[model samples]
Target: MSDTFFAYLVTLAYGDKETPTLAQVVFLSENEAEDTRTVARALLQNAKQTAPEKTRFDWSTLKVHGSQSLSDDELMGLVAAAAQGQVGVGRVSTLKLS
Candidate 1:
């Protein structure tokens, strides 16, 4: 079976719905889907602490499995949070598993 990857831009906050600081998670082509999703969530959670509440930190055009996962509401929130320098996304990960 094929694998998937998820790039995260986590917020430097405690809230699950909070903006991200600057993090990403990549799903390996050789990893299980369930495991990859878990890794993505965790990475986002970890990146939250680095966000400052403003900056162009919102994740955009990020190649991954679930851009749709970032719903319209969520995107709006991310934009607002990023405008306030809440977080920043930088240096995406290159997850590879074979």
Candidate 2:
């Protein structure tokens, strides 16, 4: 059996003030989570290049939410059930095997 793990999708934003104006998060595979973070950082850098001269990019934040664990078979079953309208979005959750 494959070892189970947790992955989180984090959104980072920049702003001049102490407070952040935007935030979002999601669950993904471990590799996907890292890829998402890398992409966000690159996008932020690109924005700074074209942003106004005085734009202050001072604050960055990351938030994680939602947790569940499912094996490959469990995930497939969930997908199949959704196709048949036997389950809804509320039933979707992470799956981890000990």
Q: Give each model's whole-structure lDDT.
A: 0.38, 0.34
Instruction: For candidate 2, write residues 12-93 as lDDT tens digits.
Output: 3323236532333343333322354343433344334533332222222222122334456754443344244332121113
TM-score of each: 0.29, 0.25
Candidate RMSDs in order: 11.6, 17.5
Candidate 2 Cα deviation (angstroms), residue 25: 9.9
Which of the numbered candidates is closest to the native, going by highest lDDT?
Answer: 1
Worst 10 residues of 2 by lDDT: 55-64
- Which residue pairs collide in model 2, if any? 68-94, 68-95, 69-94, 69-95, 69-96, 70-95
Report the Cα lDDT for residue 45, model 2. 40
- Stretches > 4 Å off in candidate 2: 1-66, 90-98
Cα error of candidate 1 at position 74, Å: 0.4
lDDT of 2: 0.34
